[model samples]
Target: MKILLIGEYSRLHNSLKEGLMALGHEVTIVGCGDKFKQFPVDFSIYARICNDNKIANFLFKSIRKVIGFNLEKIEKAIRFYLLLSKLNHYQHVQLINSDALETYPILSRFLYKKLFQNIQSRSLLVCGDETPIIDYLFKKEFKYSVLTPYFEDNSIEKEFQFPLKYRNKNYRKTFNWLVKNCQNLITSDLDYEIPMQKMGFQTTFIPNPINTDKITFQNIGITDKIVIFLGINRLSYSKKGIIYFEKALEIIREKYADKIEIIVSENLPYSEYISTYNRAHILLDQVFAYDQGYNALEAMAKGKVVFTGAETEFLNQYQLQADDVCINAKPNENEIAKKLSFLIEDPEKINKISKNARKFIEKEHAYKIIAEKYFTSWN
Candidate 1:
């Protein structure tokens, strides 16, 4: 099958391309490398003209903020229009999300509708970010969500510019059109699955593909200090529950400063990030997800005991017990600190969980296995 994946998020589509190629299918990925993270793709359409020229970028942003027009959007619209011919004529085309093309909402909707007409089968991946899901999440009162901080402190509105756009009628209509036209919806995690199902769309949950072969698993031995690593992205700090993790880490640090070492990597590219904390024993990932995101899953593939979403829903789906595979971080700082403290005090249990974490990735999220699922779903 000739498949075209139309976006890159945390290397999800890149890894999926590898898996599909291993299965002897022709796959081409087109994306912008997801901004600074710099994930690879066959066709790089990240709007380099606007991004490379800092002066122009700043000018355009300033104009957008002052007035209502976005010069960068106009530039992207022209670029996307020129690339439309190259983007067509595929057996299957899957968008990482509704907003795959780097254009304004109206333009993105038009391009998606055009692409849908050109492709034989069109699918949408309900990735971590989508307007419908975000809108739905805001409607309900989640114990903790990406919008928790924003709701608690309205001052953070400046930081969360996307959600404001997401709440707009234009954005909602664009996503709704894509959802209605797509042949099928694919969800990579439970966070997306729950909202998508609630919105009355039948979805196929395919675990995010992790290239396990690239990661080496190491058995953690008893050491003087337990190294806990936290990689922070300011853009998603509130959503990922970094504040809770930080508070928990503060307590743990004060209590066991001599026994544990906390290492933090902030805003590093994907390649540098994995290598930077390769030797760390534990990785503190997000706290508000029902299932692990790509970062957590990749750390698990590396045999790191990741503190992430391993809620009852995730456990029940995988038929495993919590704390056996991954540490389930709660919204409360005390609970998070307690869970971290438990692992810090026990070396043998960490080693056991570390092995289980890798095994879980191999059994469930291996690229080939997940790619086959994609193939079947597209068929």
Candidate 2:
């Protein structure tokens, strides 16, 4: 079958493309390299003039003020329009998310409608905090989610524009468009799956595909000091519960300053981000997720002990205990600090989880195996 995978996030679709190709299926991907992370794609419409050209930025702002639309997005929609013919006539077409093309709602509906006209099968992947997922998160269904900060204190409205914008009526119409047109809605993680289930959608749950062949496991060797790494994206600090990690790191620094080395980097490009954490024995990942995000999963694949969302829902799904494969970092700063101290005091635990982490990825998320699952589901 010829498959057209739309959009890229943390190289999820890229890895899926590789797996499908290996399984003797032709696959093509069209996306912007997911901004700074710069994941590769076949057709690249992700370039922008507004960022580099003052005139373009001025026009975009002027247009947005008058017409309630970004001029840059209009240009992107045109660029995507030119590629629709090439993207058509596929046996299967899957969007990485609802906003795969990254255009405004109305523009996206026009483009997506054209692309889907000749496609045999249409599907949507719920991989991030988009309209449907945010609708679920808004109800305070989970104990704590990425929106916990806003739920507790609504002062930080500026940081939440991306997720909050999906609540607009126009965005809701586009999402409903996809829901009505697509044959199936698929989830790539437990975070998405649980909420999707609660929303009463019979969506298929497929674990995010990780290319184990490319990511070789590195055994943790704690010689003198345990290196702990924390990466931050300034835009998502509160949403990802990264602020909690920052607070926890302070406690760990104050107490176990002699036994460990802490490295913190912010807003790194994809390649740089991965390299920055390579030397670490422990990685502090997101706090508000029931399952690991792409960065945490990649770290685990490389045999680095990761502190991410491995909640009881995740544990029961995998039949594992707390801190078994990866440490489940809650919203509490003290809890995170205590976990770090335990790892520093007992370095053997790091190595044990590191090995187990690699095994878990290979067993559950291998790209080829996951690709076959996609193929079977699509059939």
What TM-score would candidate 2 get against the native? 0.96
Candidate 2 stretches with Cα past 4 Å from truth are 58-68
lDDT of 2 by residue, 57-170 (tens): 787788889988776676678889999878766899999888888888899999888888789598889999778789999989799999899888898998988889888998
Model 1 scores a C-alpha lDDT of 0.85
As for candidate 1, its clashing pairs are none
lDDT of 1 by residue, 215-263 (tens): 6677777567899999999888887889898999999999998899889
In candidate 1, what residue range of length 10 has the lowest lDDT sum? 139-148
Compare the candidates by TM-score and give the number of the best one: 2
Task: Show where candidate 1 strays beyond 4 Å.
Answer: none
Error of 1 at 214 (Å): 2.0
lDDT of each: 0.85, 0.89
